[model samples]
Structures are given as C-alpha cells and as structure tokens.
Target: MNAESIAIVGAGVAGAAAAVRLAERGVAVTLYEAVHEPKPIGAGLLLQPTGQRVLAAMGLLDEALALGIRVDRLFGDTPSGRTVLDMSYRRFHPEAYGLGLQRGALMGLLWRRVRALGVPWACGAAVESFQQDGDGVTLQLAGGRTARHAALILANGSFSRLREGMRVRQSARLFPWGAVWTVLPAPAGFPQIELRQRFRSASQMLGLMPVGKAHAEDVERGINVFWSLPVASLDGWQERIGLQPLKQRMTDLFPEVEPLLAGLTEPVQLREARYADVHMARWHDGRVLAMGDCAHGMSPQLGQGANMALIDAHELSAEVGTGGTGGKDDWPEVFARYTRRRRAHLRFYEQASRGLTPMFQSDAVVAPWLRDRFFGWGGRLPYIHQQSIATLAGYKTGWLWGRLKL
Candidate 1:
C-alpha cells in the first residue's frame, strides 16, 4: 500500500518481528499492545532452521544464537527404560542444531530491535475494535482514541478478539492435556546439548529443555521444565492429591530432574498452559491480515509454535511485497497471495503436531502403548528417522511431500 504507517496489533513474536522488518524497510509501523508493559510469557522453545532463517533475514540471528542454549539432539526415555526419540540435528546438516531458549529471551530480542528502529509501541492501549474501508484500516483503542493506517496486521494471539471480528472461519480444538512449566537453574551436571524428555506413558511426560540464560534480567541462567498434565486432573494436583505424589513421580520417572526440584519450592510456583489448534480456512480478510497463533496456533508437541510464528513474519513480508517502499493498496491480492504461499507449510505442522500430541499426552489407553512399542524402533530407520528430524527442524514441507501429488 502507498500509505505509510501500518498498525500491528499485538507486541508478540509475530507482531514484533514484522514491525522490526517493516520499520527497517522504511515503512512507518506502530505496534499496539494491550499490556502496560509487554513481556514474553511461557518457558523454553526450540528455534529450528525455519525460524533462524527469519532471524537471519532480519539480521538478528547471530544475536539470537548468543542468547540461547545450543541443542543438537533430541533424546527421550520411556517408562519401560526404552528410548523413544533419539534424533540428532547432524543428520540434517553437519552444523545444523536447534537453539533451546527462554521464550522471553527471543521475544525480548525482537522487541529490542523494534525499539531500536524507532517503531512506536502503543502499550497499555488495547485495540478494542477496528474499522476498514477501501483505503485504510482504523484502530479504535480502549479509550476511543483512534488511529488509521494503511493495513492491519493481527498477531494478537489464538484467543484474539480481533480474529473473531474479522469473521475468519476455523475449526479450533483444545488438547485434553497441557503442561505446567517452570524455570530452574540448569543443573551443573545436566547436559545442555540436547532437548530431553522422559515419559512413563502418554499421560506422563516431562520435557526438560536447557534454556541457557536471559541477558537482560538478573535471573539469567536456567533450564525449562514442562510436565504434561490433564486439565480435568489439575484440581487433584492442587487440592486432592497434592504435589508430594507428583514430586515422587518425578523422581521415579527421571531421577536426573531431582537436582532441579529444590529450586521449584512448591507446585504453585509453576504455571499451567493449554494448547489449541486453530485451523482457519484462511489468514486474512480485506485490509486485515492475521498471522501467528491467531491465524494457526498448533500444539508444541512438535516444538514449532514460535518457529512458525517467526516464519510467518518472514513470509508475510514477501506477500506484503512492500519492497522497502510502499506499493499498491490491493488488499485482496496481497491477502490471497499470502494465504496461498503459507497454506502448505501451515497444513503440515498443524497435521504433524495434532497427530503426535496424542503419542505424548492423552487419555488414549492404546496410544502410549503403541508409541513405546513401535515408535522407538520406527524412529531408528534411516529414512523414517531423517523425516522425523526434518519435521523437528521445521523443514517438513519440502522434505518429501512437495514433489508428490495426492
């Protein structure tokens, strides 16, 4: 669009990254946030190649690499003393490795870039509603203060009211199981080269990601722990059963986590999170374009949530095709092109994550049984194992299926 300033709702990974890119390209960008001070929530996340490419494009990959722990392998242990996941990044490329990092660290990096570029962030000002016309989009803030921009980018979140207002259709489903996560000092003896998980069954899984440190905060050094827990059974952990039993379960499942327990003081210290798969038919309508979680948030089972969000910001720039200079105001053409280019990639992850979450966290009695019995061996095959690694690294699209026609 020839119009200069762009209104980006949500100061999240998607919005922040897009803002930084757009601003650097000389497009006037204003990021609106609901919170008085926006901060990243959640524990650790893995930055796959797909995500790193985006950071590199934005000239921040080196900084991102320095802020997080380097992860080269993904190893898992099952209740029966069997290793279910034993994949390594080396299989994909000799130097390729996923970076395990605090979610806040990455978001902070993006926000810092946004700030450096002089992109104005309207914090504490919630965009209550928005209006769109043939020319530009107008954002109505909480206090009725309105600002108009050439285009609207929605990265608010999966629970975004703006996405609802856009009338985008989707089949959203919540996973029965979620996670309770906490950050603990990385145990001196803990290996930081891999993202590890211990599982007793589908319902009992513990993911321990070595998230190095936070550069801007006092509490810099730590690892992230996420335990699989069902929503229906959460009250029991808080009231009826108590954390003592859960603590005992931790010791039995993976004694290695014992060193990290003292830092957790109490179960109440950990926060719970639920994941949902929002399957939208498209990610845009009119001048309003949706990206990240609000458009297509998927389960973290495959560890692609943040990566996909970052990639969305990258691909979006291409579809927006502003060329570092304002272009046409053809909203329909821009939105349609973005959707077409991103659909295949989005479809793969949504399907892969949905298909695999059950193997790790679910009430399905036979699912876990089948996983422990077959997954270990199946994951060892050269071709199958390589495919799994590709999926893990966010290269699933062109790995095997791109050339085939259904």
Candidate 2:
C-alpha cells in the first residue's frame, strides 16, 4: 500500500464520507465494516446546515434534501410557553435551516452513493486489533483476516477499539440522563417545518421534531418524539409502572405530543440513549488518524455529532489530497495539519456540549438556575445570540475565531 491509499475502518457516516471524498480526489481507498449489512438504529437526527454544507460539498445536498424535513427555527419552550430557546437559522443566514432527518434514510443514501463511487468494501471484517509503526498501519480483523494500508483511518465511533491503542487515552463520561425516543405519525396540529421542544427545568423534557418520509416506514409515521429521563431510572421506572404513566407524564408536560404519546403505551415502543463525551489530546498518530466520534464525540446538546463527523471526514480527506504515492515521509505532518485545521472547530463543539448538557439533561439542580441566568437571557443578546446561532448551526471555530464559512 502506498501513501495515496487509505483503508478506513467502520462504514458509518464518517467512514463513508471519507471514502467518497478521498476517492473523488483520485485516491485509492477502501471502507471496512464490522457488519455485512449496516443499518441505522431507529431514530431521527437533526442535520444542521453545516452538515448540509458538507453534503453539498460532496454533491449530496439535493439528494439529502429530498429525504428529510426542513426546519427553519429551533424553538424550546416550557409548558406555559416560557421560552428557553428561540433561535432561527435565518438569524445566521437565510439558507441555514436545519434538516430533521431519519437516520436510516441518511445512512441508506450514503451507502448507495458510496457503492456508486465504486470504492471497494470489506464487510463482516470486524477489526479487533491494529498495530501502527513508522512504515504503516496493519489491522487484524476477526476470523483471522488481516489487511495493511499505508494510512489507516479509525472512523468507527466513540467507543473505538482501535483508538485506545493508537493515541489519546480519554475517559468518556456517560450522561446521567439520556433520552427515550420514538417515531410516530405527526399529529393533526403538528408543525411540519420546525423542531419544537418542551422543557421545564431539566427533569421534564420532551422533543418533537418532524422527520420526513425517509423510507416506506416513515410514510405513515413522520414525527420523532423524544422524552428525557434519568438513565438510572429506566429499569426501576419501567418495572414499577406501565407506559400509561410515561404517556401521562409526557402529556402533562407537553400536551401537544399526546397524539404521538398515545401510541407509546408500551415501553418497548421507544428506544433510549445515553450520550458520552469522547475527548482526545490530539486526533492522529503517525500515518494512522482518528476521525468522527472516534476522535472527538460530544453529547447531543448541540446536535452537532453528525455534522462534526462530516467535517472531520471532509477535512482529513481534503488534506490527504490527490497527489501521487506520497509515502510515509510526508503523511505524519499532513495528519498534524489535519489536526490543526480541525482542532478549533472540534474544541468549540466539545466545550459547548459539555456546558450545555446538564442544562437540558441533568436533574436541573443548579444547572437550571445557571442556564436561566446565563444561557437563557444571553441567547437574546444581539451579538451573543448570533454567536449561539452560529454555534448551533455548526460554524464556530473558536470563542473569538468568528463564524467559519463552509
């Protein structure tokens, strides 16, 4: 394998994006996946304009736009309509609406495009271990399959098996509160073009985002409804009562979601998730590089997980250019450049997510007070409000770095 060649581990959004970008630059690349047929978990995701820009750069914007709901504003309010957040993409730019998309549809679209790009794929190739030296990186997959590449990309995920061995020993913290989410038919009075979230303090939280018809399943059920609860309480809570109580709680908190909540009469009808923060001192090691959640994963507080992953992939792929077989002499420095280019952007999101999570997902303790005093009002300030909007739209490179035009 020459330096122009890269073998990517994990066929997720990051891996696939990297593969397509590098391939487009006339580089030889292959994407490997642990599963033979990869599928997205049953959930919806918010694709911010920055992510849309990334896809647009990849020539996928039009295709992606067809698969999701277009949300012009992000509105978070208490039951009594006391505003917690009221940020509009139009505040940042006219064309900066967020995309409420079903994860399955996004993944499916990417997979098809990757296949069309003719990049080779090695599926069922679970990379159990890897060894990186000055020459190159070698991966040992399950069932004794082995592969080597001049440069290997670890784009797997937050809990990466390869990241621990290569660089950055990070202890990813699990949030005490996660979310229970599901998709159902949008109620008669549902807003089709906005992400409306209900929040009272922190313990009482619910999100209703309209996810368009991504696939056949979504044709009937298009709104994604989510309820935030303590992660530790799921087991005991489920055993102690039935879904009626949960539905009642959601209905009591956000009556608008009652139409969807009524269908969630069974706990099994929804999925729960606990977010984590994956921190790394740096994001590369010699010819081996980590991208996406493998390098820097943060909570969904900012809703930038997928956008950040797209940025990581695109940045690295751009740096790993369309040159001839460059060899090991140059890649390490190139990887360093990739880190430098991505560091500020990545750090801003991580810091923002950390500061924002407790406000929305915790027990509200002191965070609610802190949030109301700082975030709630600060977001209304002219300058700070725009900055917050830029951050939410995935454009901040640093605190004072100003907005980054994608």
Candidate 3:
C-alpha cells in the first residue's frame, strides 16, 4: 500500500486530521469539502487530552496553546452558584493539558497544516455518489468531476451522505432545550478563571469558557458569556435568545452568577438543541470507512467531540500505516478491530455525559444538596479527582497510541 492514493471526504477536524496523518506517512491524499471555505459556526471548544495529543502529534500543540486559554480546573455549579464539582485537566491526563479555543481558530490552524503537508484538496466539491470495486473506490463530485482512490475515509460529519451506502442506522434525542452564547469584553487585570458550568435544570446548562486574551473590539472588555438553556424548539428562540431575557432569567434563578451577565453586551447567538447517535454496525464496507461524528455523535456535555475525533484519526492512521499490506478483505478486520477498541471508551463517555443531565437538572429538594456534598467529598480526595479527570480526558493507553510511545 505504499504511496496509495486515498480520498478523504469532509474537511472538518476529523477529515483534515486523517488527511494530515495519511499525507505525513507519504500516502497520496485528496480531501473533499462541500463548502468553498470552512467557516466557524459553533461556539468555543475545549480540547481534552485526546485532542491535545493529536495536535501535539501533528506539531501544532504549541501553536494552539498560544491561541487558547488553559483553565486550571473544571467547576460545575447549580443555578444558585453552589459549586458542585471542581477538577483540573492535569489531574485527568498529566501528559497533556486542556485548553479552550473557538472552533474556528482550531480549524484555521489545521487547514494551514493540511496545505503545508501537501495534501491535495477540492473545496466546494460535493461527493454526489461513490462506487467501490474490490481494488478501490471511485467518487463522483457535484460539479461532474471525479476521483479514484484505493480507499475512502468519510469524515463528512453526522449527516454524512456516504452513510447511505454503508446502510448505517441513526437515532436522535432532543433534550427539549438548547443553548446560545456571545462574547464579551474581558475585564482589565482580571485573573485567569476556570471554565464554569451552571445547571439551570435538567434541560438547561450554561457554560462560560475563557478562550483568549481580551481584545479591544470585545465590548465591555471583561470575558465571554455563554448562556445556554433547554428550549422546546426554534419557535421561541428569538425571544429566548435576547440578552435582556437571558439576563433577566439569570438574575431570577442565579443571582450569584447574574452579576457576570452585566458584561454580556454582545448579541446572543442562538443554537438549536438536538442530539443524535450514529451506529454504522460496520464502519467499512469495501473501501469506505466512517470516523468521528460520522461514526458516533455524543452530547457535548462531556466535551469529548473533538477529542474523540482526534483519537479516531490517530488510530485509523496507525491502522492504515501498519495494515496497508492488507487488501479490501483486511478492511473488515481493521474496522472490526477499530470498533472493538473504541466502542468501550465511546460508550463510557456517552453514558457518563448523559448521566450529568439528571444530576444537573434534578429539581428535587435533596438533589442539589447531594450534588454539593458529592463535589465537596470528591474535592477532598485528589486521587478520585484524578481518576475522574482521566476518564473525561480520554487518556486510555495501549488501545490509542499502541506502542507509538507518545
């Protein structure tokens, strides 16, 4: 499989990461993107250890670290601002640290690296259809262009069209709530702050993450305000997304945290609330394989989205490098092996993230008290904090890096 040409669909972090890894191995790679230019649509992202390791592996860690903020701890709280849990990224994965950055910034850095690695890419080109023979797969682009490769990696994301041919099943869960956020001016001489999460209810949680140093254009010049809540749908999003409404709501329910809302002068960005899971049952049939959100979508509560995608790239690239001698018949074994190794970790994170909703949203009188007690007790036990951090940080060894020793 030396110098095998591989087609990678989608250019998000997962697709780009895969493309970068394959190209670094001297594999001829062509990346396809439906969008003319990748743009940031989501809010901020926290790169857990898994993601950080992938970036470090690509030699982009220092660059990313410079553009982001490293919070010393993860602090969970109630609407009343009672601290529920406090843990740090280092406690979870001592080898690496977690940092917060805008989704767009991360993509921009990856895009630069992808081009520098010499991976050929076709933007604004949709994959209309694809067919795979025993030897390779041929893809038809939206504008009538075509490309052929020995293998195809579908990192096209959750709503991937390629999943149709793979015959994968998908299920969605709508939490009847959603979130919206806006950036604000950072305070002058403000101290570095930890990421904050406040549970207003089972269907709502607010996260405030410090992404970078304050800029002049950010009004009020204090910090970014991410106000998320559970809503029924888009019908009332405009009203609910208003700064006044959000400010009022926070003032009523979270007086302690409300003072921070005074700095939220920027327009609120409303985001719909929906969750889904992708079950390919088989990741590859013939030369096509799905990774990242295309393979499995988990709630953001765990903040493992980017982390899981990077780990997928790391493992997939390793498999491609080691198992290239294998023919198409070998892919099923490879996919099976990949699935077997990742399924447990993915499920663990999924369940762990899902479990957070109940604890955060429980309106029971005793629930908040219990949650506070749990955090207080956990804080007293540093080892327990470390174990919890490792699990959330996605630092499992052997299965991930193998003997790469990184």
lDDT of each: 0.81, 0.79, 0.68
Per-residue lDDT over 309-363 for candidate 1, one digit per residue giving the tens place of the 0 to 100 score: 8888777667665433356446657777888888888888888877888888888
How does candidate 3 fare on TM-score? 0.83
- TM-scores vs. true structure, each candidate: 0.93, 0.93, 0.83
lDDT of 2 at 322: 32
Q: For model 3, what is the alpha-carbon lDDT of residue 176?
A: 45
Decoy 2 TM-score against native: 0.93
lDDT for model 3: 0.68
What tens-digit string does per-residue lDDT give for candidate 2 at 127-191?
Answer: 88888787777888899977878778889988786888876656666677877788877767667
RMSD (Å) per prediction: 3.0, 2.4, 4.3
Which regions of candidate 1 deviate over 4 angstroms? Answer: 1-4, 216-220, 235-237, 322-326, 403-406
Question: Candidate 2: where is the Cα deviation over 4 Å?
Answer: 1-4, 216-218, 235-237, 322-329, 373-376
Local error of candidate 1 at 116, Å? 0.8
